[model samples]
Target: MSKHVAYTQFIDFEEDVKIRARDQARVVALREKKGWLFRLMLGLVLIGPGVLVMIADNDAGGVITYAQTGAAYGIGFFIPALLLSGFIAYVVQEMTVRLGAVTHRGHAEMIWGRYGAFWGWFSLVDLVLANILTLITEFIGVTLGLGVFGVPHAVSAAAAIAVDVVVLLVLRYYAWERVSLWIALGNLVFIPLALMAHPHWSTVVAAFSTWRIQGGFTPAFLFIVLANFGTTIAPWMLFFQQSAVVDKGLTVHDIHHGRMDTAIGTVAMVAVAVALVILTGSLVHGMPGASNLDIQQILRVLGQRLGPIGEDLFALGLVEAGMIAAIALTASTSWAMGEAFQWPKSINMPARRAWRFYLPGLLSAVIAAAVVLIPHAPLGFLNLTVQVVASIFMPAAMLFLLLLLNDATIMGEYKNRKWQNIAAFSIVGLLVALNGVYGLSVVMPHLF
Candidate 1:
């Protein structure tokens, strides 16, 4: 292999080399073992980037969006729609795994290397802005979720920052991945919380066949559809998972495992989303202005209907959603910046040695947390707006991703197959069409 390709495909840091070497050795040993349980153990070790990206995709903004969808429309449409979105997310993210594993470079780095600086910087700026907006909503989740336990916003925000910094700085890449996965397990809290709502099983099952939007083709319905799309398959996910695969030292050999990891995460992501919608739909649907109700109001209604325990579990889930996402977003920001600017970047590097790599992510999180503390800020709108912004930006991001994946010079044998390209373009087409429809709706309000 050429030096350029080799460098693109592997970490250069001594610390990263040592750690990943140890990990690779372990994988080899596991592969030599002869049993299904050993295969499962091997799979566990290989399952970080995909799972983290998907679960983190269900961030605080996502929690709010799902809750709002449930409250406004019930489980009639979005439950099945959530499953579809999960498939979309998996298809997109699986490509990233292949790209990262084949090239050993983050998405930003690949864009910069293959494309030009103009496009590269454009993609970078777009990602940074979207990540900042999305990160702020995450802090909104952290503060609001903890507010249920009587924790003040400032305190919750500060504590969240502390936890994020420690996790990013103190842990090496392997440790960070393990810890993040453990925290991500908290996302399942929404499942039991949904159960607390005691939704009718028949109604939930019937939604698959019904698949009807509650309010028909209204502007609000369109907005929610876009918001759900944004939350499910945002641009940051493409960057984060690919960078994570690189940082975690996945190679073309690990593509199968990486794909499996992404698939599992996709299922978890959709299941939790369905649960959130069900929880709110069973309790809050049909309330006055349900579509317009914010997170706090939604929580209050949940409290009223399911009692305080339901409220607390939902709140705890929100906090977990925010905290885990903050970790991923912070790391995503830091990794993208490092890749774009050629700064030294790797989670394996200790803070004392790689503060430049870590500072941007930390700073972004602090700024987002500060914004969440603004008294009477329209956080609910801000949260939904962030997801919409992501939806608007996704097509551009997807375009770049498609171009990279189709380039045989880079992807070689792993170049996107014909079916994959079709699926990707279809997703982009749907996003563009919806955006245009939304624009038409705004311009000529009487048409619908």
Candidate 2:
């Protein structure tokens, strides 16, 4: 009886080993079968949130700011400055990735849970309000762009709203991200427009070497620089990217991928900004009375210089910029409200289940659209107000971000390094001073 038992045990152990070997072989085979196409698909799936935030950062406001920079300063100092801002943007946003992956919490939720109601509501209100105002600017860009092709403002606003609704309602989180990424990719149209302008390559190369401002550091020049800073790193971006990273289901293992995604986006965003500057700089820079040209006038100048193709492409870029930003800003608002209130807070939730989460964003968009359609609205003042509000709210947002990143109870092994903290603090200090200056300039026009 003992011998029979021993033989049976040996047989069972052999069977277990064989089973283990088979499973291991299967896993290896599956891994080996993952070809370049498979890897590519996987990468695409992992790359949406960061890319969306970066592209959305290059919104209508950003495009206008870059165009204005090129038109006014002619790419002397702003190009390198934009490149540096891109790096700063990356540094700041990378914290969002780490925070999201490690904590699986949105920025608003972190502020609320870690701090208290006051700071939480403070951040939430600031984000939602900024989002609404930014949405208005986006619609304005959309209507203006479409108006170039004879589409009325009402029709354009309606179309933009419908598109936003369909994208949010019909798609789950992954699908929504993928769709938004494709729309964001449309922003690359500015590149060819830059080429069409036929910029002098030698001069473009020499600008960086010289690194001199065309008009020196005048008050107007400083204002544009601050505008560039404001547009590049907004409160909405922090909310949007963190919530997006969480919603996208990224884990700590995926942090490397997230960083790659953000870096790629940074390059793409800077490239587009530089291209816009080059396009407008080549055509509109130093033109008679062109220093203060609005976006419409900039497009008109493009049409005049490069003809209809140039005009149409620039218009298309504006439309894409506005559409992409609206998608991100609306979603950012929804996510922040959901996180703050502890509602069903995912784009993956079906419309019926997540209506509460979606309502705030939808309402904000609708209100913004309605505002845009009103006859003879003070759009210039409204745009300035957006910038000013963002400036006022920026320091608070950065403070919360820094606090959360340094919270050892939350971040564990992934907390901010000393260098990162130093860099971030330096950035915050500079932004605070700049925002103060900008605020004074806006409120008291003669201060600068």
Candidate 3:
């Protein structure tokens, strides 16, 4: 068995090296070409990890959170909040692109390599726990969304897991990423759905000037704020993007393209997010118990206000959100595990040789999907709670990220500048304070 495994690794390694050589040769050739068309072609080639991560960031949990936000509070406050979150997402994720390109190392490997075993183990455990929890929410979104069309929960969960596994294991890295991106485009379904709602453009534009939560600083208000932050900027995103950049074989030369990719994705993410909020805010915001309704109830409201077709479109969007996120999350889990254990980590490697690398992610997805199949699960609360949990864990993740970005020995000239530090520090500071306030709201119940 040992000899067989070693032989498979050797074979996979040789094949992957050839694959990378061919891909990089094209990249070098493209770099030398000087024309608008060539530049556009180069941008398309170099744009994968950044855009995928950003799109996957708007996963099932994100869809639910944004929808809930609009249902509960209207579009007044969160429209601006989502915009701020997008800025924060770009600021934080852009750093990862540079870190990965400069160091050619995954976030897990760097944390372990530079910070000692204790910190490494801490980060790995945190990421795995958070990722599994997030995957459960993704599965919940999948099953619940499909439930709209009378699809059985069991079938949806099983089918989602099966598709997710096939996509992860069947393709090498490049094909896997391209397929995921195509699916991610389904996230924009919410835009047309929003337009179908015929929202008051004047009210939507006025949200920026009237930036205030509908219900003062209540516990519900606090939860939505933190949940929004959590969904927008999760811990898993950091590990996912950095590992993706490493696996994609992006280097310093591609950093400019990486930045462009991230920028494009950020715009798309914010656009979809705002669109969902608009759809729900227009249709469900004034309904009784809007703040507390589960996604099913929210869908019912949308159907009554918009119609069955609108409801179906929203459900389709939800399923796509789950599918895309599951793909990205499963890959991230596999990559982090492989990096930490010093296993062969690239998706370019044959799955037969890297089964150990693939198993953890697929296993997590199966478990999450199974949990969604269980009867009488409190999935709605669980979805928001997972996002809150991510928010709570985010400060620690950001701390590691900031430390890595500022390390002169590792990052050298790529080390974060003063403005980057200020922006990052502010994000971390806001997360910490929000977490503290949420804890107070739970404990004291009357602080606000």
Candidate 4:
């Protein structure tokens, strides 16, 4: 039995190396295929991890953040700011692409192997806890969206769980990536919903010119700004993208495609976020008693303003956003755990072979779904707490990411340039400061 187990491990390792080589060889073949149109098609096929990560970043919780931003502040400040945030997200996430391609290791593995166990465990625990909490929010979004269609919360959650399980268990890595990209593309539903709102095009355009706040730096305004920033990039994003790149078998030669994938995703993410803000901003902004409207209330107002179809479409977008993010977050947790513990990890593995690798993510989704089924769960508070915890941990995650990216031995030619480090550290500084203020506000409400 021991010898059999060793044989299995040996087979898995050999298969892993072959898979990586195949990925690199495929890229070489595509490059040698010649025609621009064929290369374009090949590029599209290669687009997966980066696109998935960015869109998933604009999750259910993120939708709510954008909604609140628009409802409170109109289109002024946030629209263009979100676009800039997309670029910032790209800049940071781009490093993960290079790191994954060069090392062929997940972010967690790099930290554990290079930086030592203490930091490794710290990153792993932070990612797992955040993923769990964020998964709960995804379930909440699913339930809330489906609730509008008269589905019971339990049914909605159960269905979501089933879908997640099927996607993870039945699909290989390539199929899973393609399926996820298709689902993520559905996030465009928000664009039509925004159009349905009949927002003032001029007002939306004017926002970029002014880039000014309507209310001028109130505590409430600061809070929403931080929320937007926090949602745009998170610690899980770093783990998910790097692991995904590795799992997808990306190599340094394919880094350009990966960067393009991430760029496209960043645009999609920001566009969807801006659309949600516009949908709420145009319809509900400055309406009587609109200041404190939650997502349910916002949906209610949407129904009143744009009829049942508009409301239903918005709800559908919410459901898609939640499910897509749930998929990515679940996979992130699984990959992180597998990398940290040196377990076999691949979406391509058969269920029997990779059950241990897949179990953590599946169990997390089930648990989160079960929690959402409970009567009167404090979902709103839980969602806010997820964002706060993400902000608190963002600095540490970025620290490791920077450290890894800067390591000349590991990254070789892919290591961070001086400008990359400067920009990354600057972003980290801002996040740390924002987190400090946010923490203070939570701990001492009167101070803000």
Candidate 5:
């Protein structure tokens, strides 16, 4: 009688244990489903900064430059020339991906700490001046583009200032970046616009394959290429991406997604640049000495060839480009200033913790907006001002970036790797020498 009772009790215990195991499996399955949703959301959240950085990298200046390159050279050279530096961009930008992931520091802070105040102040001063002037140009772009749409200069400048303020004030970094990424999508319009030009695909193909140079590769072309490269890689991009990574709290684990984000960004930029070239070349090739085009002239050309709709679209795209760029440029100014001052410098930080960090960006944006709308503002002088200053300061800026990338103290194991340094230095040397030759050509007249 006792043995039968004990066996029955053992069966009861076994049934209870099996019920618990089944319940546990269901709970595990529920969590697994939740994880998939969480990751999808995070991936969307993680997408913007890299892409915005890349899109903004293709600023109004770049659009005009690519247009001019195609108008002058007919895409024979830069189609492939653009490809060469694309991975150079991918490789160079990838390092910032790692730096931001590992250190969670902005470029200013890294240089300041790794080298000293001397270099730190140097970088900060350069960034601040370049950023201010560059920001003014973005506003100029916005105003010019809006003018084509019949928006008055004073009204458009004021509206642009308002837009920048609202975006900076209302959103946390996450929301701000996502909104900006949507704005950045305007640049994609160039792809359809470019295709609408009815370019001979075979001609585009031949241009890349043959690598033809007009009148056989003059110094002027070299300078133009160097400037294009400069446009591709800027000091602010390094600062902006790193600060963005730090703000997003990207840690060692997120470096994979960050690098992937950067690769995607690199592709977006190169594609847009190529599209700009094709758009200009298809419409304006073989014109009577039509190489010297600028932003305002590009609109005239678009209006002439594609009718008012195409002209309006290009203007709208340019406005969008300037808007997106203004956001990044202002953010970069804020990040670098905050880092240099040792103030609370993160977009992730609560407002109180980082208001000092955020204030300078707001002020700089305001000043830039004001200056753009002033009557008889010596804008032609300002246009020359930006180029002269950028030319004067470019070498120093590139030197600091190279120095920082190579500094084992900052980058540690992630230092520029030998081959990367070769490309970097080669780019730097080429740019420097091209400037020299350009100056000579300008003075000599016949050499170019």
Candidate 6:
């Protein structure tokens, strides 16, 4: 491992953690015994993973999805709908915590070992390609957001890639993670921006209990729905979380806290997602000229209503969202490639130590940046393609994930309990059926 942070690289973090078991337990106890201190400490210690997960989910495409959702629905039902999406995200990601801890292996490695090369190749292909495309979108968000601040696209794109290279190549895991977390956590700027919109609280609340669609299911509704689903959870999330757990050297004892981290991320994601939908939906969706606008278009319209400040905040949130997702996606691609090919891959290692592990990510960031620069590319269709790929790969991803979690050898005594299995399978079934409906709605426009 490269010269990195003190905790994990120099020693077996899994074993060394045992030496500090006393302090670890004390920290947990301290968190429980106090209120404000617990909150503060929790924020300090548990901040990275949650912020990463949430912001990664809210990638550039996600912002566009939320933007479009707000323009069409006007905060009618999507606010509460996002609550369910967040819950789903938590339930799904929490499984990876136990899987990573119990097995001491990344998801790709586990799948390759147990299921053999066919499935391993399947998973890898999905992760690498999806990651590359997703990174491109992140660059797009950054460039577009910078456009709001009067930066040239080429300069912003080059600067963003350079910053990523420095973070990945120069910074050690601890510093890299901390910097990424701070940038990712800036996704919460949306909350204050939403609050500034001054939406009617009663109407927002009613959108939840009213059980009414703003104007019934339309093509725009379908677009936002799938986009929301894609943004909330995807193949990259699983790959990233599992690899993170492997890199972090979490053991069985930390599974509980790991799950807690996932849960915190879930709530924060929904809070921001809902706030965004409600902010735009209530403020601009039903305005005289607002009708089924996309995210970029929505930002411009929101500026018209709330002035430059609202638009600027939206742009800032968009950039943060993209970069946050890019960090996770790139990390995920590196880890999965490393594990699948049996290369040395760990954030704890320096770039020299794990050049093979880190190079894929760097190259991906470069290619993605280039992809964003292609003249008159059909970005709208490319976003649609991302969603389509997610739908296609989801069943296989969930199946492999379930197989690993249910395997007695891997999970040991911590295998999925009945309720966990129920939740997992239920999610799978629901997603399958939901996609089917979405498909039918696309083919037969009047049915939904």
Ranking by lDDT: 1, 3, 4, 2, 6, 5
User: Model 3, range 279-395, lDDT digits (tens) per residue?
Assistant: 999999888888888788988888888889989999999999999999999999999998887787888778888899999999999988887888888877788889988999999
How big is the positional error of residue 113 in model 6, measured in Å on the Cα after superposition? 1.3
Candidates 2 and 4 compared: the better one by lDDT is 4
> Local error of candidate 5 at 4, Å?
78
Q: Which pairs clash in model 1?
A: none
How well is each residue in 1-448 modelled by candidate 6, as lDDT tens digits?
4322421233354543553354356446656766787767754654455457766788888777777677777787788778888888887888888888888788887887678788999899888998888887788889899989999988988988888888877875556778888787788888988888888899888877886676677765666677678778788888888878766656686776787778777877888888788778767777776664656778887798789999999998888888877777778888898888777777767788789999998889889889888999777677756865685577678888998889897688988899988988988887787777778887997876
* Model 1 quality (TM-score): 0.96
Work out how many backbone clashes candidate 4 has: 0
TM-score of each: 0.96, 0.90, 0.95, 0.94, 0.85, 0.89
In model 1, what lDDT does residue 66 have? 94
Better-scoring candidate (lDDT), 4 or 5:
4
Stretches of candidate 5 exceeding 4 Å from the true structure: 1-41, 216-220, 349-353, 375-395, 407-413, 439-447
Candidate 5 residue-wise lDDT, 1-448, digit = tens = 6633532332233332342343334333443565677666556656666787889988766666677778878878888888876776776677777777667677887777666789889888888887777777778878988999789988888888889878876676667778888889898888888987989999999986687788675766766765677667777877888888876666666677787788888899999999988998889767776776666777788889999988988888888877888889888999998777667665544566568877888788888888888887765346434544565466666676678778787678767789888887876776677677767776886775
Give lDDT for model 6.
0.78
Model 1: lowest-lDDT 10 consecutive positions = 3-12
Better of 2 and 6 by TM-score: 2
Instruction: List residue ranges in candidate 1 displaced over 4 A.
Output: 1-19
Tens-digit lDDT track for model 2 on 159-202? 99999999998987767988999999999999999998899988
lDDT of 5: 0.76
Q: Count the backbone clashes (under 3 Å) in each candidate.
A: 0, 0, 0, 0, 0, 3
TM-score of candidate 5 against the unseen true structure: 0.85
Off by over 4 Å in 2: 1-37, 439-448
Task: Superpose all Cα atoms of candidate 6 onto the true structure and report the RMSD in Å to 1 decimal.
Answer: 5.2
**Per-model CA lDDT versus the true structure:** 0.91, 0.85, 0.90, 0.88, 0.76, 0.78
Return the TM-score for candidate 3, rounded to 2 decimals: 0.95
